[model samples]
Target: MKRIKNGIISLILILLIFVSGIPAYALEARPQITKPDLPFISAHRVIKAEPVYRVLADDKLHWYTTSADEFNYWTGLKGINNDGIAAYISPVPLPYTVPMWNMVKNNAEQYFVTSEESRDYVIGKYGYCDCGIMGYVVALNDAAHGNAQLYQWYRGATDYVYPALAELYGLDDNKWDADHYYNTVVASISSYKYEGPQFRVWSDASTLQEIDVLSPKGGETLTGGSKVNIRWKTMIPGGNISLYYTLNPSEGWSVIDEDLENTGSYEWTVPNSAASKAIVEARWSYEGIDANCYDQSDQYFSIKLGVGTPINWALAFKPLAMKALLAPAAPSNLTAISNLLQLKPMLYWQDNSTNETGFVIERKSTGSYEKLAQVAADQTKYTDSSAEAGMTYSYRVKAVNNQLSSGYSNEVSKPVFKKPEIVIPQSEPGKAGQVNMVFTLDQRDYSVNGVTKTMDVSPVSLEGRTMLPIRFAADPIGAETVWNGTDRKVTVKLDKTTIELWIGAGIALVNGVSTPIDSENPAVNPIIMNDRTMLPMRFVAENLGCTVEWLPASKQINVNYPH
Candidate 1:
């Protein structure tokens, strides 16, 4: 029975072998499979360090790669790129890019295949078709992102045609076989092999961190000024686009720019911190990556996460530092003046800690702020004595570092007040220490838009028994003043404009035209008590087209143009 059972099992095994037929051994162990000792062939590449083939018969190029794993790394002759651009070894060497032929001149080696494999293709195995096809590739380049370099193999007057190539938009020159022409590079691989240890890689994850808000970026620092600065840095390979910002760098920085979805970087403010504090960062996610880091080429620092090392800033922000953006055009840095001085309300700003030139001393009137001055490359300080009395004026100073400025300084102002009390000893005859003379008053109502009233408060005459004479200041003619000269007539010439007055020879000459003196020309008397020329007050003012101002408390007079 045991022998019969064993016989049955053996018979089953034989039957199975016959039914399955000899199992085909298509695959071998990793080490057992013999690698084909094929000669290695390589060419200047647009994508992967791939294998490019020269049709041993006709040298026209086609997509060629030994393995599909490196497909993403390929772009040119081996890519089948939608752009149809490829690169080839140039036949003529170049010291630099000879754009005359629209070819990218990289300093790589060159070689050639048999004429039978290329230019001689039509009749020969490799002829015109191969040459033409290769020639077409020589002129192709990556227009997608403008990176891949394509090269054509040609030796003729064939013109190059660029597609959507803005950089080469004006490539018109084509020198035939000259040193200036961009010659197509080509060389057939005399030897070939399968390169082992091929490497295709992905990046490590990255991140950016939000740092701290800084102090005055060096300009005005007014309006709660630009004293508070924004700060941020990288943290992860993939960050939230919602983490970017522009105006407000301090408050909730999560709300990023809407355009962040459409663009790679967001706009941000820079303080004129002399580049010491000026920095901007971009944040985004790179999904599914390894062996990498996130950094901005235009910033001052960077952080590498792959290594457990605390970023020393040497490599973190090294290759990508934009130090120029930190020096901003000054905006709000200024000095507010609460104390008004008599000489002129001179504004003096705090010297810039950054010590920069090209400053602007802007002033705000009342509560309204506008560009008061646009002084460029200016040093500090400005005099503002032109302000009216009793008017509460506000002012602030600002400094500019490079093009960046700080916010306005705190506003400083004071009400310029004028006195109104008057003590007049009656205008009677025969008074002590009195002399008759012409007078004019300078009283203005700024609250009502600088409206002023002028009247003759004088009995200026030598025939009087001595009355008080009002006081006035040094002024040009055309105002109310007394002129008591012994001469019978007075002569005067108006300023350089279109006016001239001569009150001599018993006639008044106005602009070379003779006319009688108007009664209003001398509204006051002419009294010569002291050894001075005293005459009617209104004659001097009205003759020169001036407005009068009088202060009652001080009994002072002033004359001015219609400013």
Candidate 2:
């Protein structure tokens, strides 16, 4: 209902005060000079407490200014015709939890408790309080919760919102009107918490100093195949800070390119691979002010690029120039081909800077640089044939012209690793010591499936195999194993936890605990030979949620994972 207490306090106060005392004060034997202090006292006494109008402060608090008021204090809490009800902000020197958990649960903060009727005015239909009664905003951590007054319930009068939440045990008044006092709190700690802190981004270096980046945390390094999160930490907590980024001297930086709100941090990435020089800049562009990350003085402020970044300078392009980069009849696609995997890095740019001589793709683990592939002088494309199966590799592509190179392209970091292989050994139908296993694997490398025990560990060489329990080879397949021999359960931690497979006797157990594996799980019945246990890979892979692709032409089995 758009609470107007804080919004219209001046109007209400003006209407209530009388001018009779003003004229008499000045004529008080010329003693009216004390008018400034006298009127202030009378004003505060009106509310039975000291009340000071917010004013401008030079420091961060912005102390008494309306800008501060609009942003912090809720209009719903301006002034309530001397309801004789008030709330104060004071630290209760006791168990922190005692006060925090209790008062907050009641939508109450610190020392003042709102009447049931008052509660309805805060959250119920058309309820708004005088700004003066409500304490100054302290802090807001989420769009749902922050120090800003903008996020204070939007003064909603929804029947469900105020009633259901207020109905929780402890309101004391069965007829309590949660709708009236929902906004009674300067800061309410509702159960539905805003998970991450509010992020602030700015282009001005000065403001940037005030912000803290939570993601891509300082001193934290991400090689290939890692998530790039950009978060902002600020003194003034609020909901949804927009993030911004850019590279290139000509195209000055901006606050946020993405439209998300109250995001303290965002997912940032540079071509999956590390780069020698790439700006992974972050800015909170949500509000009108870009709280941090702008260098107004400099035309182009390149973010401090770290070492070992795989960069392709030739393909870098500014967002506004995307249209121009595309209009020039140039194909922007890189086709990489690999037996097991193919990873292609994309690049872009707005205008033609110099002689586009393609780009250089570098790997950090080893400072080896490769001309992986290239595009036309005006073209923007690169193909990478080095994606190793089961192994992760990082990649980034930038554009380059004869004169100078553009800032490195945005990062495209992902790791490429080779998949592992598993095989089963076959034993001579009637022979105990004579067993053989030759695995035709799709991937090149893998690890032992589980901790030993299911299979006896003695292989003459990597060639011969015996009857070993599946548990011994479970790890490579990404399976978690727990068995005391009787109640055997294999857990594939990839997606879910299970306890329903008893090898000897088919059975299932609840998750988190152990159960028996089923006999049907194994293709072949246990044939004790060479003093080892052996089972089929198909059964294990399927139960573990792994994708098994069998190639009839080459008799190859590929076991992949979501597991």
**Candidate-wise lDDT, in order:** 0.30, 0.32
Tell me model 2's lDDT, rounded to 2 decimals.
0.32
Instruction: Write down the lDDT that model 1 would get.
Output: 0.30
What's the alpha carbon RMSD for model 1?
32.9
Residue-level lDDT tens digits of model 2 in 1-563: 24677658867677668544476657567434543422101000000111222321111111111123432442233221122211222111111101111111122111112233443333221112112223222233333322222212211111122222223323322111122222223455443222232111111111112344444432334454344665556443442344443343244333334435644656654433333222333333222222222111112212333455544333433333322221121111212222122233222322222334555444332454444555556544444444554443454445554433444433444444322233432222323432212234333222222212222133111112122344534554445654432111233343474533332222334455433333433223222222222334544555666565655565444445432
lDDT of 1 by residue, 1-563 (tens): 99999999999999988867855553434456787744312111111122232211012122322223423343322212432212332211111111111111111112222233232222121111111111111212223221233332332211222221211223232111101111113333222222221111111111112222121212222221123333333321222332222122222122223213313333343222222212233322221111112122232221113323333332333322122222322332233232211324555543322334555554555556655664444455666656565465567655555534544544556444332233232333433422222232223221111223232233232221111222232121222222322121233434532222221111344455654344433212222221122333334444556565554565544444442
Give the C-alpha miss distance for residue 111 in model 1, angstroms.
86
Winner by TM-score: 2
Tell me how many residue pairs clash in candidate 1. 96
Clashes of each: 96, 120
Candidate 1 TM-score, true structure as reference: 0.21
RMSD after CA superposition, every candidate? 32.9, 27.8
